[model samples]
Target: MRILVRVLKLLVFIMLINHLIACSWYAVGINDLEREDTWVKANDLKGKGTVYAYTTALHWSITQFTPASMEVVPMNELERSFTIVVIVSAMVIFSSFISTITNAMTQLRNLNSERNAELVKLRCFFSDHKVSASLVARISSCIHQSNKLTGSRVHSEGVSILELLPVSLKCDLAEEVFAPTLCAHPFILTWSEYYSRESKRLFLAARSSSLGAKHELFNTGQVAESMYFLSSGAMVYVRGDTRPARVSPGQWLAEPAFWIKWKHVGHASSTGKNCELVSLHCETAIRILSQDASTISGARRYAKTFAAYFDKQFDQLSDVWADVEVLQAMVSEAFIKHEKELLRHSVASRVVKDTKMPGLLRRMTSRFSGVSMASRLSSEEGMSQDEQINLILHERVRKYGVDGQKRREILGTRSMGSDSSDEVLAPVVSPVFRNPERRQSIGRGRFARNGLNVVPGIASAFRIMTR
Candidate 1:
């Protein structure tokens, strides 16, 4: 549509330029109409109609643009000079027009220029090699058929462009682009309802690929490296000589390869001109699901859900048990499903987050870190002895009331938490002392600075031992 609009614009520009040139020629004819040597007199346009005069002028103007010779000859010096001017102007004007068209074409081709460049390189690579022509043709055809653009496009370019994005954005973009395809799957439709984030990361880790018509994705007995999701196009699963089952879009192939070591038991191939499949490698699958301990259990739950989904699709368990092998398979699948659910629950119950002290409780407990109230208050640092005594008095009178028994209980709580042998003592008198004389009146000598800063718990224990 853009190219078409540009072409239309160029055409309109051409018409406008020609109309002006013709008008200039008509103006020249009118300027010297009476002169015998003038174009109007020499062409005998005065005897002819206005249409004839204009047509003659337009013809002369067009002759300068194209390779054709001019039909009307220049009559005099002025006419010859004007002819020279028109010819010179035509060169400049035509060059500009040619450049505009060339640029527009180049811009149009730029869209597929990357694809074209790769094809050219591929052709050059095969130029000297004596490879089969059929193989070359098929390779080229597949390149054109697939949409593997090698990250040339990104902003809304689907999940294939995720390699350029950050880990977080990759997960987010994957969630947005592959969610519909994932949720469309019968197994995932229910599975994702519980583990949506894990499902998205699983899609992120998957590598998407394209296949041409009848292209064998994997042959029977081929070592399986990836579990495939048929995002688009039909696939044929051929096991031994049985009828090839047509696998539709939004289906899984080699699902067991995702969780365990496995090999292809069937051949899978594209059915039409194109196929797009996203394969989650066993390594990548485990990495995505078991990023944390929580997700490990979630992965088991996913396997359990997937198993149950397929298990319900079969006929009654009794009917399938008619064959001994079928009976064994059913029992094994049931056991696997039960074990997965049981482990998922068990693992979830066992994940214990680190237990740290609560902030409020820690702060409250820290207030009783020292032996006596004053020494305990000293553990906080940056306070004078008088300030410590004032703080205790204020807190006791304001919050605990004037009861000495409650104050003793607070002291006991502090004593229980304190290790006074290792703590510094900062003794404070209960009654505020204004002078040295007042402090000395307690009768206890200067060295006797117990003041409840001693080991209260040890003393109590010793008293108990004596009893």
Candidate 2:
């Protein structure tokens, strides 16, 4: 469009120059042709008279001509023709310029309208996704508190609100209620690492389904086209003859649909009015990932880790069990669900010991200690997965925080029990201070500093005892 406008302006400029030159030439022709000598010669033949008798005196000659007169007549006609041509050219160029300006204005108006339309579409998108004003404000608060571009850290010094709650309630707070809001946050999409944001947002952009009371999300045996995120209201997954588990908000449903199976095992339906769900179709998610360069770069790195984890869990759990719950349990322990059972047994063995006491006493003590360790593990296993993850995240975000190495070591070592041969050993130090002269000097210094003969006295007592 710009190029076309430029071309049209250039053409109009050329026509204006042509019009000016033609007018100048026409003016010069008129002035030269109207000079005294030219005009007198043009009228000289018109002044000639002929004598005649009284009867012929009244008769007039209608036709008369001279060479100069005939030439002037043709010149006048030629000048008029040149003037008309110039006027016509000027009019055409002027009209074209006006039309071009009109067209340009019309185009600009349309472009503005198009931009407004796009803005409206985006507003509608946010609305349809249930991104309300309060949700936006919550996201803003999270961003403000973190003051960081990445979700790697959280700034609040407080413990998680649901940290000590029961498994079901904690899951409700962390996974169902809290997580959906975080996933929907725009900053999480725009400011986090590319793959991190894409993986999250791809699911966030799923098509929304608004359901009234008792509407089903999917039926058992239905081909698994998408996995759903419940944004608002309540839903339940019902298996035959079983009381349905309440589908918590912010939780992913039918996750097996995305990977393990092509069909749903149980029927999911809304239990309340105005239930809102967003579903991520497998094909759409893959296509989005493929189109983005940043996501593609990290896809291989994270995908393999996730795939291995998923397959391990799938193999360990029964088909009738909920995959999401199993996944949550696996994440909390940093191990698969089956491994947790093994780890629990290992804990029991570590706590119970073979001692030199009476047989019945030893058995009683062993039994009690074993029960204690087992109970501890069971309590830990009961924590909600989201709560556990938040704890890890909180630890990671605090500056100058340890890597939870002590916790890991305690768990790892205790799980292996006393009989495990793979235990790591501390490095041995040489006994340079064991030399008599050095040992005496060190002991004397320690005694002097303390104003007590404690070190020297202890050394003397040890020697005497050994002797």
**Candidate No. with top lDDT:** 1
Best by TM-score: 1
lDDT of 1: 0.53
Residues 205-313 of candidate 2: C-alpha lDDT, one tens digit per residue? 4555556566567787676767677777888787667777787666567544333223565788877454766666755654554443221122221222222343333
Model 1 clash pairs are: none
Candidate 1 residues lying further than 4 Å off, grouped into runs, are 1-166, 292-296, 301-467
What is the alpha-carbon RMSD of candidate 1 to the true structure? 27.3
- Angstrom error at residue 14, model 2: 64
Model 1 CA lDDT for position 428: 17
lDDT values for all models = 0.53, 0.41
lDDT of 2: 0.41
